[model samples]
Target: MTASQDVLGEVLADLRAESAELDGLVAGLPPTGWAAPTPATGWTVAHQIAHLAWTDQRALLAANDPEEFRREATKYLAGPDAASFIDDGAEEGARLPQGELLAHWRTGRAALEEALAALARGVRLPWYGTSMSAASMATARIMETWAHGTDVADTLGVVREPTDRLRHVVRIGVRARDFAYAAHGLEPPAEPFRVEVTGPGGQVWAHGPEDAGCKVTGSALDFCLLVTQRLHRDDARVRAEGAEAERWLGIAQAFAGPPGGGRERRGAPAPEGDG
Candidate 1:
């Protein structure tokens, strides 16, 4: 297969694996379980999955009708309710019956995969703030699935085992370094920092200029948790070797949208191990 096709296949495979794992977590839950509050303030377990479904719908629209997607996006971004649109969409979906919501999420995910798979090479889909190729879109979906799935698992007192699928998340986190700075109105460092993390399979995954003085190193789980804002910087085990690199860790964001109010610094986790 061509390299581009290979990327599309690999990323979509990982996306399916990540989504299926989260589905397994919520599929068997009792109706009452949907109401369990997660770490995201005012968001329930149902809201988490609902948000995923809502975003998947948006992704499908972006792939199928970029012009319409842009029009809708511009309208939303200009409306007074723009700040709360994400919450509002999740709330609307969460109000459905548990079974109905589950089915909606499943259908949306399937439609998204099919739409993206049929796209031609070098096609770019417009997103909330940027555009991406089919493979990049799939990787972003995987990253969100794993991050939100972490929230759901935490709510249910379940500890999810980190998997190699996080390579996608890690890559996004590393690539988004400049976006993170720009989101916060700060200029990124002139030189790229070397990022090296131990992967789930104990393999070392590295990025950036090898000769750069700035560096961030940690377990993949720790970095993912931090970049996704699922874990506070104080609670993550990631290490930074330079002043700028350290500051980047403090503002790193892997997902699109506003700068997140990250989880509170709860010192209980003891910064010794990976999430």
Candidate 2:
């Protein structure tokens, strides 16, 4: 279901907050830092932000002119490797001077936000996967920004400040619980699963059947990191109860696309405050 105006406003606020935080992380980086390799294999800091800029521009197209967006997508799909689109685009974009890439991202995000706010109520916009409401699109944008920001932060040996804004990411993770199973060609369990995550501020955010037999519980940041595939589920503090919930945790994903071949065990250190 689409969020009401008040809820959408909150989501948009969080989206801007996430972008601002990421901007701070990359704003003053030297050329070396921009060229630094991130956790995403073969993607540098420039590649990461470049992808965000490209995506925001495409998402804005989806919001304003889906037909054109679909046509462009069809052209992209005709390429040999559909999965390599982001990688290829990022590599190309990385060729631009660092200042130009950053300026492009700032402009693209502003345009995307404007386009999203102008969307009519109850109207669904086309996306790479399922169509989405403006609220969902905004939330998805925030989730991606934050996830990529983590990679950039990690490469620089910096820690990002966490916030309750992650609740949007956690909500999407819970909602896509069944999709995770289906993406693996497994039938989602018939019964509902309970999810309880403690946010950064210690506020409890719960979803699903309040009395469901299955449950997943963990720190909200850990849950978000897991769903984004940034942290290996096994390496996270998140735990599950009941068979289906346990399996879901093993393959959970909030982002759209084929199930990601998630990050492997690297003895990766936990995010700030995760311990």
Candidate 3:
């Protein structure tokens, strides 16, 4: 199998595992916890779960009608406080009963998987403002699941193991370095950088050139969590090898769109025993 396919397979596995974890967490949430506030401002656990379901449903629909998808998304954004509205949807999703919310999430996820599985290899699907193939789309989903899943896990004080599958999400974050740079009105780094993530069971996932001018080295989970802004930069588990690499490290983003609020560098110290 091709490297991309292998990476994609790992991503699919992560998605399934994350979905199961979310199911259990949501299912076990008490009614009050469902409405409890998450770290996201003004959002509750319910909103996050709901947003996932809604986004999956949208993805399934958009995969079949790219133009219409763009139009609808544009329209959605045209509304006043559209960004806040979208955030509200995610935060409010957990308001429903555990069973009902889980059912919706499962249904949307299944439809998305089916839609993606049916795509022809190399066929690009419209997303945000770019075109992505089935593999890329799947990887994006994996990143989203892992990033958002962190929020849920944090609220519940649950520590999740770093799976090898997170490599895909990390890769997406690495690839998006340019986007993040551009979002800040800065030019992207001229030279490519190396990314190394230490996975579970002592596995290491490396991307970009081996002798790249810059290097990002850390535990796979920490790297993923850091780039996604789920964890702060000073979390102490991630490290950079070059000045440019460290600059990119401060503003790394995996998801689409402009740079977000950005992340604070304050957190715990890096963990010992680098991968």
Candidate 4:
């Protein structure tokens, strides 16, 4: 298979694996823990799971009919009862028992995977504002699952090991550096940079030009978490070096659209090492 196809396959696999992991984790949660606050502000464990399911359902709708997807999203955003609408949906999802909730999560994820698997390589689906191919969409899903899953795991004191598939999340994060800068109304640095993450078995996953103006180096997991905003820059284990690299470090993002204010690290120190 081509490199892109390989990456697509890996992303799909990771999505499935993560969905399963979330299912198992939620299945064991006590009723009280369902309403327990997670690291994600104003969201309990149930809210997180429901958000995933809702997002997947939206994606499926978008894939089938882009116009309908846009209309619904816009209507929801513009409605007088927008807050109540969202709250009601989430509340309905949160009310599901652990077993039913997990089953719903699995079903939604499987449907999304099937839709992605059926798409042609070049086909684009409406996402946020622009269009993205199946591969890009899959990559985005991987980043979201891993990042949000970290929040759940953190609240429960579960340490999830970094997987090789997390490279997709890292790549998305690297690509989003420019968007992060733009969100802040700053012009992205003109110079390019190199990103290298140490993965399992001593494998080094590097992206961008080898001799780029900047270099970011650190563990794959740290790099993924940092870029996804699951962990703050200071809280990450990765180190970046060079002026341009440091600039990119300050504006890295994985999510689409304008950059968020981002979560605080509480008492974490800025990540050390080379960019």
Q: Each model's TM-score?
A: 0.96, 0.93, 0.87, 0.85
lDDT of each: 0.90, 0.85, 0.75, 0.75
Point to the candidate with the largest TM-score. Answer: 1
RMSD of each: 3.3, 3.8, 4.8, 4.5
Candidate ranking (TM-score, best to worst): 1, 2, 3, 4
Worst 10 residues of 3 by lDDT: 266-275
**Per-residue accuracy of model 3 over 112-188 as CA lDDT, tens digit each:** 88787667667788776467877788788878777777777878888877666677887898888888788678899
Q: What is the lDDT ranking, best to worst?
A: 1, 2, 4, 3
User: For model 2, how does the per-residue alpha-carbon lDDT over 68-179 read when each residue is reduced to its tens digit?
Assistant: 9889887877777776776677888899999999999999999998888877788888887678999999998988998889889989999877898899999888888877
TM-score between candidate 2 and the true structure:
0.93
lDDT of 2: 0.85
lDDT of 1 by residue, 1-275 (tens): 78899889888988989999999999999988999987887788999999999999999999999999999999998999877788889999999999999999999999999998899999999998579999999999999999999989999999888999988899999988988999899988889889999988899889988888999998899999999988888888899999999899999999888788787788443232111
By lDDT, is 2 or 4 better? 2
Q: Model 2: residues >4 Å from true position, as ranges?
A: 1-3, 266-275
Give candidate 1's TM-score.
Answer: 0.96
Q: Is candidate 3 or 4 superior in TM-score? A: 3
Residue 233 displacement (Å), model 2: 1.7
Q: After superposition, how far is residue 238 of candidate 2 from its true place, in Å?
A: 0.9
